[model samples]
Target: MTKKVLAAVKTDVETIEIREFDYPTVKPESGILRIEASGVGGSDPELYRKAGHVPVIMGHENVGTIEEVGEVAAKRWGVKSGDRVALHEYLPCWNCEWCMKGDFRLCMEVDFFNVKDRLNTDRFGMSTANKPPHLWGGYAQYMHLPLNTVMHKIPQDMPATHATLAVPFGNGVQWACLDGGAGPGKTVLVWGPGQQGLGCVLAAKAAGSYTVILAGMTRDQSRLDLSLRLGADYAINVETQDLEAEVMRITKGRGVDVVVDTTGDPKGEIVKQSIALAAKGAYLSLNGLEQQVPIGEIKKRYLTVRAPRGRSYAAVELALRYIGSGRYPIDQVCSHTFGLAQVHDAILATAGRGVQGAIHVCVEPWK
Candidate 1:
């Protein structure tokens, strides 16, 4: 029997068509899972807006329960059908040079949400690494996980909806804790107080940063409040207040040791402010390019501007472990929950205002 699923089609400029398609009827592979809740990403805003491209599956962050599994995969991953798991975006070529060094994220044949295959066109742009064609992305009713990729079993006690936030939160931990060297006695500035920005605040605090100064807009008052609750030492309203002055005041003129730019606004003023707030040797980690940087300051200050590479599955797993440990509250990042049908509205909500404290956007898998 053919199952039914939703497909994100570009209907027009700044619009998406959520039409249903026949789902994959193939059986599950050994040790693999059929995911449930897949998380949406901030990077996908352009895709939704049809700015660059239009009409793709349009989901990356996700978690789900194992619906069925092949015998071999079940034994190998210690995951059986019905086991809850969070999906990693990358499906690495395990034997590749990078994967050999345990850098799976750098694999040349990596598939981000199984969108494309770098090797053969024989599959009609579908990835045939280790899973069947039916299992591809989580935007639909089913997604496939190759045996070699990093798919961890989340704690049974944690809801998959909450677990869906892991990818974004893991991004926070990876960018702030592991990449930016955020930890004890260090100060970090988190620019853009959206879900990802607030996540940076929480991750830096959890990583033991001396202080986390948040620079956001006056409209982000709710996010600022949430940041304070999540452990921000200071939250600066960049809209009304002077950003440079606030950063200087918070750091006592020395500037923060690190700055995390989760907002991809290239021309957005917050990015420039973030650059100015970085100390000479400070690590400025831009998760993605939102806006262009001023070359003058970059040349003069000797700033180490870098973009975050793929996260350590192990590091992300550790972040998930931290979430399970009850020490740092992961649920604090989620702001709301909605069924799969409400996806368009969810996207609109994210575009409207900041999902302060990580709004839990839930997608109930078809039972």
Candidate 2:
């Protein structure tokens, strides 16, 4: 085994430096993972541009193989050498009530927003690399998996590239199926054709929604087409067509039963549009962090508004099953791949800046 590991460290706003670190000694309660693929989400650009924690290794969605596992960790995690797995970013204290209830995503210990100290909240890709072990994130050749790290075994037949879809697919299952209440006999409107929005389209279709409509700008023509191929009933180019009118025309003025906005629209324009397009007593699942919503409009419409956080244990399990089923062309969603040295361009690709027609970008640390 190599004595050192290589990683892409974000030293400042919009800056990435490839650095090397000594391989961490394996502890009886911990393990080391050889990263295969690290997914780049829409949020990655913001994390790169915003100066929060300096010199952080930022790649949260990670899939890798177990290179070294301590005896205790092996028994507790039920894994051994050479086993492929998808790692969850959250590192919650197992003793917390949220962890006990299997909602570890809500645990305050790993809640970076609520917690002040960077060391206390150990979120993969967000935590500072200044701490010991030095390889906390997936934009590296290896990642240090602590005792409390959450992971799921990947089926031997599934390719690592396909397994990389777990996180986004899980979010789709969480926001669309679980939070938006998309199912049989329901009409769903997903207000973004990004990777997350496309995931929602798949989840809604799998859940047997009567109609799944995906909305996007003209720049997302390729993504919208892909969404249709994945079972979305309509893909509206909101920039060209009248969004509300087109939606009403499709549903015969009844409006959609569920509206899921993953646009992350800064001005909350899409959110307001989602509220207006929703039917009476409809469910609205939003993933945007900062958005101004009209409370009076929500109350008058009797809408059930839900802000979906990260995926739960059940959601990830379901997403894995869906990915393993060969059901939809989920693998097609991962549109681009970059080597560790191209980490800057990789994040830019996800933001639709550098790469043309890029959707879901993956960073191959070893490449």
Q: What is the per-residue lDDT of model 1 for residues 56-77, given as tens digits with 9 covering 90 to 100?
A: 4446677777777766667667
Leading candidate by lDDT = 2
Candidate 2 Cα errors over 4 Å, as ranges: 117-120
Per-residue lDDT of model 2, residues 1-367, tens digit only: 7598999999988999999999999999999999999999767898899866678899989999999999999999999999999988999898989999989999998887798776447789888898889899999999999999999999877877677778888888999998778999999999888887888898899999999999998999999999998879999998899989999999999899998888776666878888889999999986577786789999999999888688887888888888788877766777788999999999998898978999889999988
C-alpha lDDT of candidate 1 relative to the true structure:
0.66
lDDT of 1 at 260: 86
lDDT of each: 0.66, 0.88
By summed lDDT, the worst window of 10 consecutive residues in model 2 runs over 113-122
